[model samples]
Target chain A: MALDQSVSRRRLLQLIGGASVAATAVGTLAACGGGGSGSSSSGGTLKVIGVGDQEAGLRKVLDAYKSSHSGFDFNLSFAPADQVQTALRTQLGGGNAPDVHVVYPGNGSAMSMAQLAKAGLLADLSSQSWTQKIPDGFKGAFQSDGKTYIFSPGSSMLGAIYNKKAFATAGVEPPTTWSELLSVCEKLKAKGIVPIALGAQTPWITQLIPYALVPGTVYAKTPDFDDKMLAGQASFAESGWVDAMNKYLELQKKGFFNDNPNGTTYEQATSMVATGKAAMAVQVSAVLSAFRAASQTPDDLSMFPFPATDVAADNWIPAGVVVGIAVSAKSKKSDQAKSFLDYCGQQENLNTWAEAVSCVPLYGDAKVDPALTLFLPALKANKAVPFMDQRWPNAEVQPTHFAVVQELLGGKTTVDAALKKMDEAYRKKA
Target chain B: MPAVLVYAVVVLYPSIAGAGSAFTDWSGIGNAKTFVGIDNFKQLAHDSQALGALRNTLLLTVAIVVVQNGIGLLLALGVHTGIKSRMALRLVFFAPVVVSPVIVSFLWKFVYNPAPDAGLNAALGAVGLGALRQDWLGNPSLALWSVAFTVIWQCAGYSMVIFLAGLEGVPAELHESAMVDGAGTVARFRHITWPLLAPAVTINVMLSTVGGLTLFTQIIAMTNGGPGYATDTLSTVLYKQAFVFGKFGYSTAVALVLAIFVAAVSFLQIGYLRSRETAA
Candidate 1:
């Protein structure tokens, strides 16, 4: 290395700065001309991405599609739910989005149908044969500007999953009222059993108790709570959410939860209920199989609608699409992708997909799984509401909700103070 | 021209593009971004979670720098003595450094399990010290410290290896003469060895400080910035803001602030330490 004594530090900085400026200019220009999906012009490999078990199920669907559709091949990929959103967004930004990608049914998600459709990243699927099969309520989740942009095969309900054996052992039935729930906790505690296996260490798990309680307390009285929230007429702090938060805190004060819930993971919480150490946990219906797998008698695990109000009829279960799929706007084989989605929408294919993943079928005529029969009464009465977070304005609110609830549970903040913080996050102008 | 183009494309372009977002209301989605002019930074100042993240980042960095370097120096000293098993001990201590931070965090997460009879609590309870067991990663006050301990645990051996290299650079004659002069062990280390180890100290401090400041994977894996915003650092908050919240402009402002802090701190620390380096 030769010494460049003539190059002063100031001059060196200038040179570096100039080089960076020139590089940025070229980089931006190059990014503008970034490659589109090369196979977009005609039949080729249709890249499909899904998260977790959705990917595995989609793989089976794709394998079927490949046999029936001769012109196009399919590439399948999977990521965890959060990472799937990240991967889709990154690819969408780079203009090489997957030909078919898993999307959330509605807004408040990163790859929400509303946002993707707004960005013109999803191909219109309004003309697909499957569009007629979608019921009116689900039509809004997959459509924007009166054009369908995504297809959801099924939905999942969020409720309390309990060990039937433990409940039987304690001589208590599933509680249908808030007071009954408290009494059941007392009975379980008296019997030396943990009433609920809470895993607040996981922020998602921390939000579950509040979510499960919010519908009956808030939505039952005000059915349009989330709509009001989106319209800025209601705030999380003021919309009976405080009552819901109070009920969650009440559970803690009454010592109904497991020891060191904040330290326990979602996996450990599942194990707790699976092994009959704890009686129950507030969880999504999707994880019922995981609980069953962890126990010798998988049949001992069953679910019930978690009641949040004293009036039994006021209780509502939260349910929504687990994941939906969208065709990339820039895809070359978009027709093939739509063809595959159409095949998925057929009653037989829908049943296969739903049964494979243990999700509730979306179509009216589709077969409902026996495992999910517990929620049919609530569903039949039309008492099930969409998840509160599904209609939230943006992703920031749920996380803030998670953190504040965790803090409340950890004794770091009061319910009012935590909800106040959530209000601040929710009110952040987009 | 090619060199300038490469630098512009790879380095200058992204920084400029990223900095541009710090001033606008971009959401990393559509191309439309309205210039907000310092609103993001303004929000950060009042944003309690952002402030908490900044405070936690500083605390984590300070804790990591002091503790990691101290333990590394101690380990180096221990292994440098005429112990026959020094090589094996060195390998054992350095093993964690080779493992990815994500894996290390996962492993330590199991170790810090909050269950009454699982992991750390189980061990604590087994020794008839059950009362000492607490939720390690779930309590707000303890989560930050617990994560910091895990970071230090993973990186201390890295610092030790650097110190050991610096120790080898010290000639035996200097220590022999100092011992011959009847100087105490502490005196010899303080007067002779400590001053000479300045280069290693600077390296270890710089590496640990940078690592601690940019800490993300471990926190995300171990606690995800919970049991309630207690363990969030700047990087994790930035990820959440940009990716989850879709606040690209605001997150860029956060990134810009973090970049400035890290650069200024590293520059100052390295400068001060370099000036302290003794000429052999």
Candidate 2:
């Protein structure tokens, strides 16, 4: 007991000492740094750690904000995409999480904003007006109960991004509907070009095909899909999710995708479509910048939301996803953080974000880039959904989805078998 | 014992913590941790995805151990012929072991690409063997073999080195006496050469078995265990659960099973090898 007491006492002292040192370092950084947390009384820095793309945009936005308000400085640090989550967990575990960060809650991803909130790591921004202003449809995807954990600047529309030039040269138009998309794929293939660039080797890339179709399946075939599945009132078989899997299988059968599509990577597909070797690919709007960066000109590529079907009820299904931002609960500068979130809600910053990233702003009158016009119809229709894996019950669903896609492509498991495996996987605790 | 204790804290504790988590319903993180005993493991019993991973892991461990050790022992014997070119050949054979798995994965990924433009497919076509070309990493029938080949390639040399070290330690007088006793090469190898290389066999078998079973980085970088779970292993399953799907408890359970598996196999190998040494 004495040894235990002494050991714990030493640990407590060490923890307290560490905390004091951190507080002092933050103090020193705040004193010298000019990043403003909007409502800062002593003028402190809002340390934001995220991917290079978001960090860069945040820095640009901060630069503009700094032009108007002289006190705020952003002590910006970034990790490449792969390292972000691990870095965040390490920092947060050390009681020094970034004041601002991005959260992606797909399968296997950590630092999910909701998971953070569930852990009491997120600031309670229930009072934030912008959180309330989020569209009702989007609120469920972002907030749990009545509390907001993250603030996403813009939402993404998932679909095929193709080279307009290549399509025109091939004497083909981009697919407007699912059948038409397949038909367009056939035509592209006839021209001795690879049709769809399916990056199946990257499990997540395989996910986009089904993710783009989830809304249609739910909204069209079974309106009660989400509720029924959650309530145990439905299974994957009943929901036409199996039908979606069959369609994926048919694509493999038709040879509409690249040969050994499972061998291609997300980046390789982006390169293929950008270079006009492949006609189309199903990917996220976030990939637009990457596609653009890979392309000769940003205008060379364009997006189209997943093709509409005959079901009228499917009109509400948007092929887009939501990414929100939330403040950390343990932050000392909660008031300042809330004010900054409010600032993000302002039209100026929202517009700036839309312009910089070619993103669809969730609120305010931000203009969509001309290139993203193909997806405007769906976005305006209010049919958007968050990434499907983010909404799944367990982590297994994400990889299960990957496995199913691979099987569907591989000719090993039938659609029914694969979907059965998926539905069963969802019940797993892990 | 203290050093081992430190290792237990650093390593074993996390595993035990994972096992504890498997009993609870911890969704990655949070204070709302719920206790639901045996639920995660129960879930695994019904999980075909986890079952697929288990199958793949077992298949891979078996194949790589048998194939890698077979090749390694063959090469060790083949090259231990006391030739001047042996040094150069050793460098060539062991080269893949030093290259990072990530770089090798990229190289093999290209080789596995089934497209007409792919190097392997193009070469097949050039050789009039187009029909023989397969989507080595994309076809469900082939993905497992594709990854296993890479594992064997990378690890066979390591096994060879272990066997080589063991082979070099064998007394030349024993082999010469066997030869003088009218023993042929095959007879000498069967009794003396094989029996003495037990330590190397144990080490090589254990190392390759673990390497094949755990199976990360290369499989992930090369194939991400796709073509419909054809290449999935326990580590990949554990990863998909904990990190991807936010099922920390269940994923940790998978990890615990893997740990126990590695331990059991190691124990068996060591015990078998020690007995063999005593028998000799």
Candidate 3:
């Protein structure tokens, strides 16, 4: 009987301990704006789709809007990033689209602005003042031929987010030149370290490395590379695409990347770098939060530009406007939808958003915290280039990128063949 | 009438809509639809992912139906010979089928865990079988088979039970007379028990073949049809394109192909199996 009582008491203690821990975690997230602050309003309801972790930040603005406007109310729902776009499409297809939403094209993301724009589902917020604040370079992510549709409140830039500790062991500063980067890889390999944690298993992730590296090539060529190519004035085979693939082949040839990259998935690659088994990763800026959690170092990982070439260095940035909020053009209350875009530009909302998602803001006037630092070298050299696969004329080009990467890593196709295949695929799209 | 209307509204209409939209670029919203003739189908035929998924799905179906039946028949023969703990054995065999596919996937995902520190690998290392350790989900060559094995392992017990039921209904006098004629267990199985177990075979093969075709949750929860289209089934590719990419129009076309493929293949298999049964 005593044993039973003691066991029960122990179990009770454990339950209380776990509950307290969970409460604290929830409290911390809530303090950051997870939820519970949206004020009640009486106006026709506005539905917002976002993440639960981001609810705290969203609620600050949502609650204020609801409270101040006695005539309107907003109902917010949270979904993981992968679920948002599909759910939006389904709801829209059924004629029940949400008032506002978040979007992720997902791995090898075939989701494009073209699909949204062509369908006329996305609203034209071309009239919004914030649109002008966007750089001439990044204006196309939200717009196709200079008309705005859906609004992305923020975006995640792709780059080499390196482990500082890994750099220290290799006795190399983060390489800023292509030659230095190769030397660094050789040095790391000599020390029994895998210089690059490449994952071809996801196929999409394999493409991210090349995509991140292509910004410099775009800069070397000019900002109008995509437009020229899309308009039939430029050819991919002529662009620094050949050079980019050559660099990738060089990395493979040097034994710089992990063995059997095709055998590794996105998670495995991330784990490799995070666990300090591998030195660096070429991925999106959005990976900071997840990378921090994975490595248990929410602070150590930092971003930088890939060391392409000197001429390319100045133009090597891939930036896309992401997660913009737009009112539906078909919406009955166009005025309300317009107001939401205005709200997105507000200082508190901007701060809440950038801080919440750990994203770099699109606007120059928007206040940025010094702690949310990214690759200053890369940012200075290259501005945000558009996400590569998104700019493809046909959706067919997107899946091609995923496949060629796998082929490259699998050793089934050489760099030349992959590029040739890409041209063939793109030409078909044309 | 209301129920019928609800079914039509909820299920039948969408299905027809999906099939109809396969030839068009509908994107999934609004009324504007563009008919592009066979562009989407041409894409599907060359869609490396879709084609790979179709091949993988068929591979899984073929492997599962064959292996699942083979194991079920073997179990039936053993269990029929009046064994102790027969009920306990039956319970153990049928246990996995009662668990949900999600749970089954999760359980075997842990078993197939590629990391050295994982449950299966650790056990193998412990048992001096470390040589057999594999990156089950990560290896392109092995992932599909690993996923197929998980599905087969889970459902094979149900197949066993069905066959056991068929075996019970078999006349014991015939088996005894065969034994009196000096016919061995293997020969008896080939001639007598196997011929009688046709109904069970038909049921198991048909069900398992369909189960393999529509496989989603386990693949989704496990390898996600990856290491690069390694284990992709038609369902996963359709899902990734429709849900993840919002290329619902393209995805619906893929779904049409899958529907047609499953229906046609099952129809053919049913005909072949039934003919074999009649011949027996």
All candidates: CA RMSD (Å): 13.7, 11.7, 11.7
Residue-level lDDT of model 3, residues A253-273, one tens digit each, is 899888657656567778878
lDDT of 1 by residue, B1-280 (tens): 9999999999999889879899998878877789999999998888878898999999999999999999999999999999999999999989999999999999999999988878888999999999999889988889999999999998999999999999999999999998999999999999988988999999999999999999999998899888888999999999888877777889999999999999999999988898889453
Question: Candidate 1 versus the native: TM-score?
Answer: 0.90
Enumerate clash totals for all models, in the order shown: 5, 30, 20
Native contact share for candidate 2: 0.76
Docking class of 2: acceptable
TM-scores for candidates 1 onward, in order: 0.90, 0.84, 0.81
Candidates sorted by lDDT, descending order? 1, 2, 3
Q: What is the DockQ of each candidate?
A: 0.57, 0.46, 0.26
Better of 2 and 3 by lDDT: 2
Instruction: Spell out the clash pairs found in candidate 1.
Output: A23-B8, A23-B9, A24-B8, A24-B13, A40-A332
| Candidate 1 structure quality by residue, lDDT tens digits, A271-366 | 889998899999877667678778988889888878899998888777766677888888777766777777887777776776666667666444
DockQ value for model 1: 0.57
lDDT of each: 0.79, 0.69, 0.67
Select the stronger candidate by TM-score from 2 and 3.
Answer: 2
Interface RMSD of each: 1.8, 3.1, 3.4
